[model samples]
Target: MKVIKKMSMTMALIAASATAAFASGQQAEEISYYEPGASIESIVVDAAGKGQVGNWGLGNEYEVQALLTKYGQPTTYLSQAFDMDGFDDDSILLASAMTYNELGLVKNSYDGGYSYGEGVSYIDMNDEGVAMLEDNLFTTAAFAAENPETVKAFIYASMKGWAYACENPEEAAEIVFNYGSSVSPEHQAYMAEQVKKLVETDTMGNMVRDYGKMDEAAMAQTLELAKTYIKLEDSVAASALEAMSLEDVMDASYWEMAMGSSGAFSPEKSEVSIQLKWLPQSQFMGYYVALDKGFYEEVGLSVNIIPGGGDIGETTAVYTGQVDFGVTWVSNLIAANAGGMGLLEVAQVYQRSGLVLVYKTN
Candidate 1:
């Protein structure tokens, strides 16, 4: 892994001073917006005609706003809920679900009918969710069995990219910050440190090399626990179990071919456009690479990377074919499949979950 050293003390101090100055009412000049006769829908259609995957390239911003509206509050509620001093488990779960939705990994009715007043709650991944998750995994594996080479290649590439991000925090942070408009400098630095800690301390290192590899034993154990602990509806069938296998669904070789030997996956070159949802940090690097380095052009892809503000529903986008692909957590994928979204796990970007339950010091 290539190490990018942190900012020097002098530079840090200068940045801090600058930030303080900005915070004290020395506001940055805002860009003027002249409304064009063209609507966002028209721009998106034109971009799509030219090979852009995401509609208007707006990405998760719309989803975030929608979620906030649904919650009857501002999106800042996430940061507030994360503060341990005012922690609310119920809020966290709803926030997590909302984030998952924005990432296009789950579906929810935003009719203002769902209760948001519940204090604290937990999605007991105890038995039922676990079983469902495992069932989906096996279904995926079974799909991959017919195309082992493809599955292996995709998994390998995904694992490689994920591992690289995990191993190099500063570099990754730089990539993300360059593209993520929502991430402030302080948050970027904090996220980088957090990712580093998670990767170094968790089981991500062990799973990195085994990118496409799935453990049958682990899958079985997970399934058993799911069945034993949770309530599964009668709708779940035995046939679904047979279809759920690690070997059934992954198609890494397809991605390998798509990416080519240069390791740049471009959707611009292809006549078909692919929608892409970028994980927070990964989204940054991906956008920078696509826009700055022209990786999208190189791969014959016109990519539109949507920013996730922890409130977009990526799974819904995929299900609706609004976007071709999205960056999301594994659990969302499980839920998506269960909900009958023909979504597949093309790659595992983060080896370990980045979701953390933070508490306030006060």
Candidate 2:
């Protein structure tokens, strides 16, 4: 599947507000706000189209629009300029915050955070049933078909890495920090804690021990959401997207086979490289931990991790043979497959969605 460098940004006018919602001098323990499960209707309707919402425009823009429309609220999409400053000034009343990244920044005071304490609440996409799958393991169909053992080996090592990372987040964060993290050390540690939640938690807020096993229900939901949001300009591609099924984009056999074995697979390719979805951070700490812990080497593979965030995306890089495997969102793989790249997702790394609509309650 051919993937674009970035998703198209939806246009909207950003509304600015000078209202300060928090007193930074207050102790964190003295503050409290709405519980996390607060209804979307409560926040969106109250905003009344004046409190502008922001998204990073990776793919969660669709989820934001879907939520607003579901609640019978009309909103123009805000593509960028979301930060703690935006929240402090009330210029951005609502913004997309990933649990592993932005959410950590919003809650952490040591790393120049908002320090709003418990005065903020969020709408989780997973709970709303509008979540699309985030980070996943994928490769071109031809690559997997030609090198099944290598694929299995990679999956085995990768999942082992993930399991370890989830169990020992602090050490995993330290390992990633030593690998040259893109965020601060404190923020990286915070990310490691939050990322463990995504990796091991389910949509129902239940803890799941399966690290990289593909959840069938979640995958179907993601495919359905992708069909609704991933717009293709090419008529043929658009048609392909509508007609695509989970089978067309995923091959669970490799994940299954890898899980069945206790690190006993002999790889056809001893040396392989993977491209990540973004820069070096605890968000992708599993791979770094796997490399650091010698999990890849244990599986008879020498894995090279290529940091992402260049002009090319992980899907495009993997599709063009720039990398043997890649980490990307399920929606991105769907779009690429619609364009006929035939990329196959091997494993779903993140069990739950991390995208949350964060806003202040007072």
Candidate 3:
């Protein structure tokens, strides 16, 4: 594990020395980002040239906003209450589905049973170059400052859980399946297997030797996507683009503790809550593994894991202090920073982008 050299500056710098630095904002330094680790997670939007232009939404996900911007498609934001697969069967021209979740639903259609492999043309976000980071652990700058040790404990346990999941994907998938409410056993299992490729590799398909390490180049690219595609309602999300140095926004000091004390799990206690970006699934198998393995308890902490959904805003909950921590995408957090929320990336769980695009081959 590499040493994470964290700056000791506190959030007070925001109103004090940091204020001066922002006021004196000069020529921004050329950010030369590092691309390490390899993960296969990518979010892609499905496209079709053969059908009519009528379409609905990808549950109005904030992530869908980026895909929409990239594809330049007209859309209607609708409720998930409608059967997504029904729309597909009705010949909706273009739509988006997650590689881990929705795509599988269509592929293994409960009704018509049309598999994605039959007639679908898929566009991988990484292949299309509109990808963004997903499933990163974050906390407010103030929370990190006040609870550094707690943060480290959570990251440490989570890293262990991630290693376990990467090594034992089938078991990991079962864990996710048990957590399912609206999801299917087969789909959960499928997500578990596919998500393994994403969690174990980086955006460039390079093998990620370490879990929870930030990929600088990949993250920088993600910021660019947010600025261009996810700004929403004519908002540029400039703060995401003009973010402070990596050292300022990503606090890796906790990583050092987890990496150093590989065998010695903390027994001293604390309590915290982590709100995941989406519902309980293989995407967050690591966190669940940690909880199942008693890693959180071993770390001397009691953790409340909250599941998120399309309607749930992890950023808003975190900003309002609803949770001590939150799991969200890279763009979401950076844009939150732009909105003055001060959410900082503590650990990057998914080294690759999970965004994908699907289209008809005919």
Q: Candidate 1 or 2, higher TM-score?
A: 2
Count clashes in each candidate, considering only residues at least 3 apart in sequence or on different chains. Answer: 57, 3, 21
Q: Give the winner by TM-score: 2 or 3.
A: 2
Worst 10 residues of 3 by lDDT: 26-35
At residue 156, candidate 2 shows an lDDT of 89
Tell me the lDDT of candidate 3.
0.65
Report the error of model 1 at residue 216, Å. 6.7
Residue 215 CA error for candidate 1 (Å)?
A: 6.9
Q: Judging by lDDT, tell me the better candidate of 2 and 3.
A: 2
TM-score of candidate 3 to 2 decimals: 0.74
TM-score, structure 1 vs. true: 0.46
Off by over 4 Å in 2: 1-39
TM-score of each: 0.46, 0.87, 0.74
For model 2, what is the alpha-carbon lDDT of residue 181?
74
Model 1, range 1-362, lDDT digits (tens) per residue? 01211333345456658788643432221111113443333332332232211211122122223323333433232333212221222222223222121211112123211222222222212111221221111114333434444333333333444455556656666666776545454445445555443333322224234333333443344334322322225356333433454433333444444334444432222322223333454333423434444444443444455554545666676567565455444444444454455556554333333332111111
Candidate order, lDDT descending:
2, 3, 1
Query: Candidate 1 vs. truth: CA RMSD?
Result: 18.8
